[model samples]
Target: MPEPIIEIKDLTKDYEGKRAVDHLNLNINKGEIFGLLGPNGAGKTTVILMLLGLSEPTGGSIKISGYDSTTEPLKVKKITGYLPDQVGFYENRTGLENLLYTARLNGISGKRAYESAEKLLDIVGLREAKYKKTGIYSKGMKQRLGLADVLIKEPEIIILDEPTIGIDPKGINEFLDLIRKLSKDKGITVLLSSHLLHQVQKICDRVGLFVDGRLLAEGNIDEMAEKLFNNKEIAIKAQVSNITQDLIDDLKKIEGIRKVSYSGDWLIIKSIENVTPAIAKSIIAKGGSLYQLSYEKYGLDEIYQYYFEGGVRHD
Candidate 1:
């Protein structure tokens, strides 16, 4: 495996008498979108603050690109770009002016800065709006500009905290697609922190479940389901033209099938693996018509429901 671009070991944080983060350990691979998934006040923001060297950890360590966040904070910040929940810009300045100002702050002024700023504006789909004052831009437009601001520094890693909080559904989709495109094209590692499960699941290559400042699990959706459910049986739903006791019994007898039953016009089969192919063949051989077949996808929705709402202990 490749070395992780971000590494945290035994990280902990405290505010007053309460512990905000508890012995958190995580590693993020280079160029992959890693989501910090959790509910509000779950210490996700604390972790990001510590990673960016904006806040000190109460204990343990954080390393980004071989630089210690606590000791070499300047070095860490030099290559890391952060976009907080709210993005602020010079409201009176045009979008292009705002980007140019950022470029100048980073010491890339003159024709090069102007050219880069214009290109970034086009890449972010704001070329036409480039000359418009940010005060008149909508929330989605501001977010797009915020992303352009972050990229102006040309950082290797970008940390976004609740980046899509108030945007409409369509805008959210477009923003996510842009993030994915940047990660793939520029090979920039992205660390996204969000409480929206479905949105995170849509674009994240992997995710870490954080609750109450503790990371319960981290992996892809399927891998996390297996870890949390202990390889729990899957349910397959099928709709056929005919249903009979004989057919149900035959389905139960199929290898890997644990149980079979019917409801209305649908058949519900609980199995250890996908047996849809076998099920369709049996339906046709039994002089029945197979109308529909669907296997339950083990996704973030189910995982979140099972762990948080189902009262299943992570331990």
Candidate 2:
């Protein structure tokens, strides 16, 4: 792989005698959509803040595109576009004006800033509302405007904190699509942080799960699932003449079956490896006629919950 676009080594942050982040280490490759996922106060925000040079690290180092953030902040900032959780905008300024003003702050000149603003507004689907005062914009529109402002500098890396927060479901879907396009088409490395596990599960190529101020697990969803819920789930639909609650209770007593839940005519059995055959035998002995039997693979949400509930530990 090309050298990592962002690297953190032993990164830690402390606030009021509490360690918000602890010995965090990770890497983001060039043009990859990496996700930082955790519950609130799980140290995700602190990691992003330190990476962006907006907060001081109590220990360790951060390197963005080979430039040390501690010593080369200006150079790093120049090539980074960051949108924090609370994206602020001047209520009185039009969306176009907000973008132009931010560009100027980044030292972009008049004509170029205007042109960039227009392009970004169109890119983010805000062209029709580009000249409207931001005060009148809805949450989703304001988010689009914030994203446009972040892109104004045309940075090499984009760090988004809870980018989909407070937006409607449709808006969230649109914003995620935009993020995918940015990484795939523009070759920009992205570090998207969010507490919405499902959203992160959908878009991220790889995800790092955090809890209690530490990274608990990190990997692709399928790998994580296999490592956590390796046996997978089995669903059986049956028509029974002699099956009873006693049979279900007896099946529950068998080893290897992790979970058994019924849905309409289906008995869903989640078990360890090779246990489905035993379940089948038990059902046959109970004289239940099987109508349908199938295996369904686990999704990212199930895998994430496995880690979140302390089923796996990173270190």
TM-score of each: 0.81, 0.88
Summarize candidate 1's per-residue lDDT along 1-315 as a digit string, tens digits.
Answer: 877999999999999989999999999999999999988898999999999898999999999999999999988888888888988889999999999998887778999889988988998899999999999999888899989988988889999999999999999999999999998999999999998998899999999999888999999988998887666768788999889988987887789998787998899887888888998888888888889999996678878865667545576
Expressed as tens digits, the lDDT of each residue in 1-315 for candidate 2 is 467889989998889999899888898889888889887878888888888787899999999999988878889999999988888899998999889888998999789888988999999999999888999999998888888988899999999999999999999999999989888999989999998988897789888887767876678887766665545553334444455787788788888777677756678676654566677778888878766566556766666666677546655
Structure candidate 1, residue pairs in collision: none
Separate clash counts for every candidate = 0, 0
Q: Say which candidate scores most in TM-score.
A: 2
Candidate 2 error regions (>4 Å)? 227-245, 261-268, 280-293, 310-314
C-alpha local distance difference test of each model: 0.90, 0.83
Model 1 — which ten-residue stretch has the worst lDDT?
306-315
Question: Which regions of candidate 1 are displaced past 4 Å?
Answer: 231-297, 310-312
Superposed Cα RMSD, model 1 = 4.8
